[model samples]
Target: MASVLGPLQPIVDMVTSPLFLQIVLFPGLTSIAIIGALLGWLERKLTARVQLRVGPLYASPAGGILQMFADLIKLAFKELFVPENSDAFFFIMAPTTGLVLGAALVGLIPFAPGLQIANIEVGLPAFLAIITLSPTLILLAGWSANSKFPFIGGLRALFQQTAYEIPLWLSALGVIMMAGTLNLAQIVAAQSTGWFIIPQALGAFIFLVTSVAEMERLPFDLPEAESEIMMGWQAEYTGVLFLAAQGPGFVKLYAFSALFSVMYLGGFLGPGFLPPLFWMLLKTLIIIVLIMLLRSTFPRVRLDQLLRAGWTTLLTLAILNIGITYLLVVGLPTL
Candidate 1:
C-alpha cells in the first residue's frame, strides 16, 4: 500500500499546485479559450431571441449548449489559407497575439479575495496599457494581407481605436481618483462603504461607450463591416485563421466585462449568502449581457459619427466626470 501511494504522490502534487490551477485552469489560457467560445454561443442565442427565434438547438441535447465546443473542435482541424502575395508571418501572428493579450488582461483582475494570478501594484494602469496594444495588431493583420480592402479596414480600426482611447483613459481616471489606488483589489476593498458607480455614474457611462468601441462591436464595428468591405481587415482569413482572428473579440468582451465588474460593480464584494467567486462572476456576466444587448439593439454607426462622438461628446463627459470625482475625493474628508 505504501509503495503504491508513493508512486501517485507526484501526480497529486502537480494537480494541487497553485500555479497550475490558476494559470492553466481558471483565469488563464485554457479558461480564456473556453469562456470565449461559450460567449460566442451566448451572443448568438441572445441575438436570436431578440429576433423572435430559438437559438442553437441542434449541437447538443440541451439547447445546443455544446455547439460552441463542437465548433472549437472543427476549427482546430480546419485548414489555414493565406492570400496569394500576403506576408503569412504577420498575418497569422496578429490574431494569435490578440488572443494572448486578451488572456493577459484577465491576469490583472481580482476575481475573489485570493484569486488573482498576478497582483501588480499598478494593476489598473497595466490593464489600460495592455489593451491599447490590440489596435496596432489589428492594423498589422490588415496590412499583412496585402489587399486594398483589408488595408483600408486596418486603417479604420487604427482611427477608431485612437479616437476612443483618450476618453476611455479619462473615464478610468475618475475611478483612480475616488479609490486613491491603482491596485484593482484595493479598489474593491475601498468600495466597502459604497460602490464607485454611485458617484462615478458619468464615468461609467463614458467607459461603457468607449469600451464597446475598443471591442469594435455593433455600431463601432466598421473594421469588420461585412456589407461595406466584406469582413474588412478579416477578409483574407479562413478556417483556423478566421477563428484566430475572431476568437479574441469574444475574449476581449469577457476581459472588458470583468474589468467593468471589478472597477464599477465592486469586484467580488456581495452579500454573504453566496461565495465571493459567484458574486464576482455574476457581475461580470451581467455586464457581458448588457454589452451584448447593445450589440443587438444599435445600428452600425458610420465612421465619422463614431469618431465625432468619441472625440467631442464622450471626451467632454469624461473630463467633466473627472472634475466631479476630484471634488468628491477632496471633499470627502470635510463631509
Candidate 2:
C-alpha cells in the first residue's frame, strides 16, 4: 500500500499544496457564486415551469444561462442610488460586509481529502460563528438605508434570524454529539461505516429544515417577502450594491450546503474511480438541488408560522434527535 501510494502522494500534494490556495479560493468562490446566481435563475425558471409560464427565454437560447451574467453586468454598470436620508458610511458598508463575511466562510470548509484552505480544530464552531453575523449585516443595511421598507425588512430579518439561529445551532449540536468532534474533517471520517443520515435521521431532517430557514429560502423567507415589505432590507440597494448583497446569499448557500455534506452525507468519501473532490461537489450539489426544489414547491409561510416551526417543531425534534443518538452511542459496544 505504501509503495502504491508513493506516486499518487505527489498528485495529492500538487492538488493540496499551498501554491494552489489561489486556485482553490478563486475558482471555488466563482463556482459557488455562479451556482447561487444560477439557482435564482433556476428557481424563476422552475417556478415558471410549475406555473405554466415562460421564464427569461429571450436572454439566451440555451435556456437563459447567460441571464444571470447579464444581470450581473447590468448591476455592475448601473448607477448606485444612495438615498439622501441614508447614512452613507454603513449604507455603503453593509452589503459588502455581508458579501465578504459570506465569502470568507468558504475558506473554512473542506472540499475533499486533504483539500481545504484551513482546517482549524474548531472548524465547525468557526463556521457557525461566521454565518451568525449575516442577519446583523442585513439589519445594518436596512437601518442605514433610513427607509421604511428597508427598516421593516431589517426588523423582520432580525426576528427571523433570532428564531432560526437557535434551532440551527441545536441541530449542529446533535451532529457533534454523534461524531464526538468539532473538527469537520474528523466528523466526515467518523462516517466510514454509514452516513449520519441513517443513525441520526431525525437530526438530519431537522438540520435540513432549519438550515433552509437559516438560508432564508421559501417558506421561511419572510425577511425578503416582496409583497409585504418590498424586498425587505435590500429594498434600497441597487446596482453594484445590490449585486454585492446578492452575492452573499449564494455564498451562504454554498457554505451551508458544504457543511451539511460534511455532517451527514459522507463528505469526500467515494470509490477509487472517482476523485474525492468530485464526490464532495456531487454531495453539495445534491443538497443544493433539494433546497431549490423546496423553494419551487412550497409557498412562503407566514412569519408567525415560520417562528412556530423553528422554535416549537424544529427545536423539539432536534432535542429528541440528540437524546436518541446519545443513548445509542452509550449503549452500543465497540466492534
Candidate 3:
C-alpha cells in the first residue's frame, strides 16, 4: 500500500507542509489585515491633521495608534441592528463574502521571488476578476438592508464600478503590454532593469486614479457619501458585522497598493542590505501614505464630474498611454 502511494507522496507533502500553511495563508491574511487596520487609523489621523482638528487622541495621544482598535472594540460590543423588512440572510452574508474574496486575492499576489503564497500564471486577470466582485457584494449588502440610504448607496457603487472598470482594465493592459506578461511575479522580475514607472508613467497615473476610485476613498467616496446618504449600505450593520465590512474595505486598499508596488515600483528589489519582504513592505507603506495624503488634501468630486473624468479624461489618457507604449516597444533599439 505504501509503495502504491509513493508516487503521490510529494504532492501530498506539498499540500500538507507546515511552511506552506503558515507562510501562505496565515501570515498573508494576518499581515494584510493588520496593515488595513493601521491604514484606517492613518487615514483618519492624517485627514484630521489636514482639517485642523485632533483625531482619536483619547485612544493614543502620540498619534492615536490604538484608534482603530478602540473603534473595533466599540463595534464589537454594539448592538446588531436588522431592519424588519430586510433580507437578514443576505445582509449577513454580503460583508462576509466581500471580506473573504478580498483577502483571498492576497494569495495570488507575489511580493518577491519565491515569496508569494501562490504564483498563478494568470495572476493579473485573476486579481481583476476577484476585485470586480466586491462592488457586487456591496450592492447586495445595500439592497439587503431594505433601506433607502443603503439602496441608494448600492446604486451609486454600481454606477461608480461601471464608470471606472473600463479605464482600470485598459490601464492594466498598458502595463501588460510593457511587461509582456500577466503573471505578477514575471512583471516584477521584468523591472530588474528599471521600474516600469519611468516608461509607463501615464499607465501608472491612470492606474493610481482608477485604483483610488476602486478604493472609494475620499474624493471618490460618493458611494458612501455621509453627507448625502448617511453611511450608505452599512447603515444597519452594527457590532462585529460592521467591523468586518470595514475590514475588507481597507484590505482592498492595501492589496491595490501592494499590487501597484509590485507592478510599477519594483517589488522587493531593494539593495542587498535589506530583505525582500522589508523592501516590499516599505514600498507598500509609501504608496499607502500617498493615498492617505490624497484623501487629506482633496474634496470629493461631484458624481457628474467623476463620470466625466472616468469616461473622457482617464479613458482617453489610457488609450494614449497604450499607443505610446506600443510605439516605444517597436521603435526602441534592441538590447
lDDT of each: 0.91, 0.82, 0.86
Q: What would the per-residue lDDT of candidate 3 be over residues 1-335, giving only the tens digit for each residue?
A: 26556788888788778656645455477677677778888888877888998887777757778889888888889888778999999999999888888787777777767877878899998998999998898899999998999899888899899879999999899879888999999999888999999999999999999999998888799878888899888888888889877898788888888999988999889898978888998998899889889988888888889988899999999999989999877776667
Q: Which stretches of candidate 1 lie over 4 Å from their true place?
A: 1-15, 332-335
Per-residue lDDT for 127-183 in model 1, tens only?
A: 999999998999999999999889999999999987899999999999999999999
* Deviation of model 2 at 324, angstroms: 0.5
State in Å the error of residue 16, model 3.
9.0
Model 1's TM-score against the true structure: 0.94
Candidate 3 backbone overlaps, count: 0
Q: Point to the candidate with the largest TM-score.
A: 1
By TM-score, rank the candidates, best first: 1, 3, 2
Query: What lDDT does candidate 1 reach at residue 245?
Result: 86
Kindly list the per-residue Cα lDDT of model 2 for residues 176-216, writing each as its tens digit.
88789999999999988889988888888888887887777
RMSD of each: 2.5, 6.0, 4.1
**Candidate 3, residue 233: CA error in Å?**
1.1
